[model samples]
Target: MVEERADAGLYGPDSVTWRIHGNQSMALAGFRALSLQAVHPLVMAGFNDNTVWFDDMWGRLQRTGDWVATVTYGTTAEAEKAGRVLRRIHAALPPGVEPESGLPYRVDDPELLRWVHVTETESFLSTYRRCGGILRPGEGDQYVDEMRASAELVGLERHTVPASEADIEDYYAYVRPQLRVSQVARRNTLKFMLPPMPRWVRLGTPARPAWAGMVGLGLAMLPPWARRLYGLPGLPTTDLLATANGYAVRRVLSTVPLVITSNPAYGRALRRTRGPVAA
Candidate 1:
């Protein structure tokens, strides 16, 4: 348990960053971000060459979540420490060439890092708004502007990350030609959506399907253009259907008791700012 302190960290309780990242819909947004990230060939190549995601998928997800939560809600010192560690790790990873582009890349490549940041920021904000979480006028841009700090943490140039919805859309349009659903992309993307389960659990219980259903809600969170890049046939009512299901999923997940669902870093920050706010 984190005791009370005066520090409010990078984004305080009153920030739009907190307003969005603190929402339950963030779980869904994470899955959506992964799927979106895989669309970039260089990103797929980086993951394929540098990570052991296939061998320890659950650990990969947990680490990703922990890093994001720490940087978002940990004390300023803690957040900066996490950033330094990430930079060191990225710097040590060996470089590789993307198969499609025949170009060498680093995990710390500014362009690739920018892509990851924009996609995640877009995914989180879009999920929060789409799933019925409220944001006052222009908070969307504020959230995007705020995320530039996170982008910097992951080795992106502070000025390079998109800072508004229009800039983000422009970035997507510029990068669209480079996005495609390759065989490797498909394989890696499926790993996030359908995680490995024990044989007995798969056969005897609804666990896999139930979990997949939640991930499906994340897929539905994808932008229509992304779905098209993945070759989804745009049915007339898919958006309507998906939006309804997204509302249900958000409501259910939101109802999980705070004691059970609170992120540790967020809980600590709450105590620091508001004196034992988390149960």
Candidate 2:
């Protein structure tokens, strides 16, 4: 087992990112981020060509989740190791042409990396706030500033990544003209947000409602602009409904036992904060 190193990671317990990332509401944010990411042709092309997500969605989720957990809560050494592994994988991706624009695509392209970092960070923070995670004045800016360190681990230049909440919005405005819902984006949105049920789950009526509810909730959490790009409702009421539903789900999840909701890295971080486990 990796040794727990309290306050030895990138952000430590006091960072705004640590608190927001530890909340269960981040799962919803993660889905929103993926949806937003799919709208970028280069990002989607790279993902389609480079990943095995189509064949093993759960495996991809697990692997990505593990990386995020480690970087967010693990010791400094563990986070560094995870970063090195990711950098190696990115470096080795074969150059490919984006099908939509015929533009060359490289996994390690700094611009592309910055896009992913900004979109993901914005989504995570947005979701955290929407779900009632409180933030102090300037904490949102601090969260973005702190996340730049993690972005650097994956080949993004610290300067290229936004370092404040205002900067994040500015970056999004600058990039908005470049985003569109291509066929890849539409296909991926459907696959990820409303995946086909397995035979067992399909045969069982009881599971279907719950699955649909979750899918609807995820779709509802998407930004209005993203929804508009995908031809979804972009009305204010739509956002209100999504927010209300998200809060309800967050409330329910808050009741889950920590052992069930907390992944290993988060659990370790919690223990560290609490000053070690009792015998």
Which candidate gets the maximum TM-score versus the true structure? 1
Model 2 lDDT per residue over 126-175, tens place: 88888888898999999999999899889777887898989987988899
TM-score of 1: 0.92
Which ten contiguous residues of candidate 2 have the minimum total lDDT?
A: 1-10
**124-189 in candidate 1: lDDT tens per residue?**
998888789998899999999998988878878778889899999999999998888778888776
TM-score of each: 0.92, 0.91
Q: Rate the local accuracy (lDDT) of all candidates.
A: 0.84, 0.83
Candidate 1 regions with alpha-carbon error over 4 angstroms: 1-5, 275-279
Best by lDDT: 1
